[model samples]
Target: MRRHLDRIDQLILAELRHNARIPVAALGDRVNLSRNAVRQRIERLERDEYIQGYTIVEHTAEARANVTANLFVYRTDRMRGGEVIAALKSVPEVVICDVMSGEFDLFVRLEAPSVDRVRAVWQQISMMTGVRDITTTVTLSTVIDRT
Candidate 1:
């Protein structure tokens, strides 16, 4: 029988999405699974095509030349608004999302091939149910990036 994804499985996928090169043992620790168990689940996910492959984010000047923006997301129900986060996961361009303490609830960073695409993504986020408001700012240039 084909296996269905559980919350643990989803967590594993989320961790992998953030850092594709994360060690299986470390990933297991984050998801509260054993190393072997995590390995097996990863293999199953790959075999089942849930995980096709892993790739690195380019940091070259040419790559950085693409459109990048920050989205200050204000949530209506901050404590109960997990739906907004789940929705953000569906957007491939959203590279980073930080849950914050005051004012805005989420700080989202997105990168796209063009300004139009970034605008479209911004529009999409603004329309999600729990999202109260979104203030967007496009990056002019990267002065320093350690990573």
Candidate 2:
């Protein structure tokens, strides 16, 4: 069963999302709760699997200047394309590859140093067995990234 979150829970989640390492007392100050109350709520949230994990986002100049692209991939055999996925995993530029439904079998997101590098990675993916077709789209800008 799914759990329904109230306003306080939502606010706590928002603050934690912005900074997972935020102190319980600071979080309580923001949410109008006591420190122990906030700690208990956080523990419950984790126990309920609402707070799965935390991670850091890179803000380096090299990371910001990288070329980003999305690839809509059509596989010859969607059910048995583990080899293709493994090959993609070997490519350092491949950031995310998600299995999809509907017309596309896979959606791949990659970041590389330059457009030339993007092209090279694209060619490498296109030549992989079981990859029937790939449609690549380069990102011009990211206007609103809450993450």
Candidate 3:
């Protein structure tokens, strides 16, 4: 079962989403709660898994979302789908591999740490036994991403 969150709890979550390092007193001021009450609620939020953890979002030019690419793969033998997918499972950069219904046999999404790594992932996919042809497109700029 899931726990229910009240309006104040929702407000607390919103503030934390913006700045996870906000102090207890500062958060309390925004949420209209005393310091101790805020601390207790935060503890409860953590214990209940509503507040799982925090992460740093690096804004540096090189630190943006690594490199994302899409690969359209053609296969020589359509019967070898399972073997190709199983091989891709071992490659960490292979984020999404879906069997498609057109000229291409598979549509793949890759997220690598660098452009070179993205090319390497594409090469790896190409070398698979059943793969016949491949077309790759790298993301130049992400206009909007909700994921």
Candidate 4:
């Protein structure tokens, strides 16, 4: 059983995050590990919760058709593996959330059926504990989305 992620394990996870569909052999080559070894480590990472699962992020036509926005959330306190973030996971429209370094502490990307939905999600987010202020920007269109 794997306890901690070593340097090689970290490298494997990093590559997987960039491209989950990458073949195991290709992943191994990038991380300088044998294919079998890489496979074993990935399995262990999943079991140990170092990795949750593989997923694909796409800018599909359906996705692109929706109202997209970035929410810059200012928090009163630093995150503590807290309920605020956990609550965000339940908001279906929120596709991504990040901890930032500057004026804002949390950044969220939300794609909703309409602008109204985006406002509704914002209301819910603003009411959560630790959330002090939120600034939202609607995305007009994607110039280049590599994600």
Identify the runs in model 3 with alpha carbons over 4 angstroms from their true place: 1-7, 39-60
- Winner on TM-score between 3 and 4 is 3
Candidate 1, residues 13-131: lDDT per residue as tens digits? 99998888899999999999999999999999999889987767686878877799999999999999999999999999999999999889999999999999999999999999999
Give the clashing pairs for model 2.
none
Model 2 error, position 121 (Å)? 0.5
Please state every model's RMSD to the true fold in angstroms. 13.1, 4.2, 3.3, 8.8
The number of the candidate with the highest lDDT is: 1
User: What does the lDDT read for residue 30 in candidate 1?
Assistant: 100
Mark the regions of model 4 whose C-alpha exceeds 4 Å error after superposition. 1-61, 79-81
- What do the candidate models score in CA lDDT, each in turn? 0.94, 0.92, 0.87, 0.87
Q: Candidate 2: lDDT over CA atoms?
A: 0.92
Report the lDDT of model 2 for residue 103.
93
Question: How far is 7's C-alpha from truth in model 4 (Å)?
Answer: 36
**Which of 1 and 2 is the better model by TM-score?**
2
Model with the higher lDDT, candidate 2 or 3: 2
True-vs-predicted CA distance for residue 22, candidate 3, Å:
1.7
